[model samples]
Target: MIPGRDFPGKTALVLLTSLAVVISPALAFAHTGESGLVLLLPTDYYLLGGTLAVLASFCLIFLWPAARLERLCAASLPIGSLRVPSQTAISAIACLFLTALILSGLFGSRDPRSNPLPVTIWSVWWGSFVFVQAACGDLWYYLNPSIAPSRLVRSLLRRPAALLRYPGWLGHWPAILSFGFFSWLELVDLAPDDPTRLARFVLLYLGVTIAGMVLFGEDIWLARGDPFSFFLRLLAHLSPIDPRPMPADPARRRLFLVLPGSRLFHLPALTLSGTLFVLMTLSSVSFDGLSRTFRWLSLAGINPLEFPGRSAVLAFNTTGLFGVWLVVAAAYLGVIALGQLINPTWRLVRAAGLLVISIVPIALAYHFAHYLTILLMELQYVVQIYGDPLDRGWNPLGLQPNFVTASFLNDYHAVSIIWNLQAGAVVLGHLVAVAVAHVLNARLGGTGWRAVVAQVPLAILMVLYTLFGLWLLAAPNIG
Candidate 1:
């Protein structure tokens, strides 16, 4: 229980593993016809049922005693020491693997669907990896291909501490900027799916990450500058397993099993930059879903029937991306302002930090709702490509490549199941957010009517988000 210690545990989850959807815009446009997974849109009955479920969960929170809720948030169990492999060995393997993958991207098949790099990056890593890592824990701590090699090289050479101290004022500004640029590359860049171009982007990013690590300390840079690492670290808070660094000795860390959302409660209050970064995550995920809808395209003056190439609508989409972000930020701030108005004692900065955490679940929900089809369908390609990463048509693992066809989705039962799953994730995500807000209310607003009143604005926003998320899934879209 050291103040400002190396690791402090917070227990809470907002499920905004929304990073899964943001990384694969190219795949959003890759499929067509009944030959692919066809999700039947949910009807009005589904939306009504889903919203009522969320509302019921919110009302149920009021019956729980504050102490009882607090106990749930405080729950944790040390799981003993986690034995890990040598960093150098992991790094060497990852480096070799990535190098080969990059070469394949540069020289392999031109078709994006057939190429390993695009599929690996968009489907495997962003789609499946994000979901798995967020649920399980911070796998990136050991397995991130970028960081492992950087750390090994630095350690082998006995790299000195940073020549320049990282400025506190910068906060997570670097990560915020990195995220923005990366989102643009995914959503607006003309040829993100082109294997050669995709490989080039990876190389450029690798160089930038290495240079940043060289300039700042590895730990500091990764925490504040690397977008993927930063994104994954936030998602880690929602995981049931947490890696807590030993306070007295920074070199040592231990694993613990905690309630799924429990780890977030102990994180130091986010800074202004950090708060905005969290908002950006929510905004980015929302925009990713929103932009794909026919309504979004119409706003950009593009006909859904006569859809041009991504290049034609680049400027329009780019504007829409920034527009969504700004609108969401403004709306969020406005809601915060209203909350402060409701409770004169609550400070804006503290309220922003506490309330923004509630949005994580909504982001996570939309991610599953929108991209579940992609993950389920495209994951087959990931398995098939694994044995023949170079596309040599060799099945080294002797595994049958079970490909998902339009026929699989065309089954009425199959479509019904997928549609229900999408709706369930959206509803469950919002319920989780409601529960998170309930805990925050008890902790920050104290007891009685005052406590309930403080959460009113945020609660309303969560409801709206839940409705919006479900609509995005069930709404008719051009893609």
Candidate 2:
């Protein structure tokens, strides 16, 4: 672990710079008056900067290989290296928190005043985080906080005499159930409106997930019937570490030949999964934003609702966009599989981080650029409807879908324009990430200059996309 002090100053500097850019008069002009004041809270920039900083730290640790950081991380671990138990506890807490949040939303009147930050952030970023961590590095183990609590419960419930025969399965179910349940909520039951109903649905999902894990051993199927595991075992010949035995007992295992590159083989799945997750998220955001923009145009008399069947028409469009997203995800996975065949031992952590890092410049460029459009477009609406931009009216029941519509359209044209730009930037970001990984792999070096240059394509693309989005925003509103 490098000394904490080594990076704090740099992190602080970057954070301060980001805040200044986000808060500058150039950026805030569109959100003028009370609306601008309300949106200018430091929390928004802090969250954004914090996320970036975490990524930067990961890069530093991986590329530079800091002994101090390693020590710091090691010191944090307990004598037994309590990562598993800690993961279990955290997963459980997350599951419980999610369940409680959903239940509260359902039972109480849907309040429009509730923070939408979680929903938006998750849609854009957290989904990718979960998929990348889970699919790539066996990070699911680290995230299972519920396991700790479950273990505690078992300890309290078990009799001293039963300790000799304690089951190894005691704390596994909470992590399994929490993961499976959250998956169901995101992949199957996500709904746009009727927050209360969605909340109730999520609670039920948690119950089912927890129940399933409790009944089935988390690793039983993997140990018994998973063909993928067998394939991995077969391919372990290329890995530097012994694959047949746990790292603790590698010397005793001769059944499988583990070469130097085995660890790298597992990364493609993470790369593919992370890529797909990001694509889907960006696609969803695009569909939502475009749909809203069109609706506004229709209302303005630029287009007709055709037959007063606005809801049905909207649903059809949304579903079609979702179908497109599914196709993109499938294609991305297919390509990843092909890549795996060519190079099974590709270094994953570095590759994944590099890929994600490469996209940051593009993300930065387009997010700011498109936000400009939303701000410009919504300025008039903000004045007309909200009276003051910063005056937040409370609505406890999230029943009012129009609240979002009003906020996005009325007070934020610049944001809308930026949203469109972001759609293009997202696609470009992925491309840039992949290109950087390939180039860096060829070069076999980790210099800061190279890293910045690797991100240049994405930055350029974002600038172009921003210009296009601005043009669209400036076009006359036909509706």
Off by over 4 Å in 2: 1-100, 110-191, 208-275, 293-310, 326-440, 443-479
291: Cα error in model 1, Å? 1.8
- Clashes counted in candidate 1 amount to 17
Top candidate on lDDT is: 1
lDDT of 2 by residue, 1-479 (tens): 11112334454365345434433323212211112222333544533443343233234323422233222222111112111234565777765655555654655435422423224223322333332331233343445323344344445755312233324443223333333333333333334334576565545544443333333323432222222221223223222233133366533322322212223322332233334344443334333334334444464354543434344455455455566467645543443343333444434333443343333333333333334443344333333322321226533343344444456545566444544344333333333333334333432344444433443333333333333333333323222
Worst 10 residues of 1 by lDDT: 25-34
Worst 10-residue lDDT window for candidate 2 reads: 74-83
TM-score of 2: 0.40
Q: What is candidate 2's local distance difference test score? A: 0.36
Separate clash counts for every candidate: 17, 63
List CA RMSD, all candidates. Answer: 6.8, 14.1
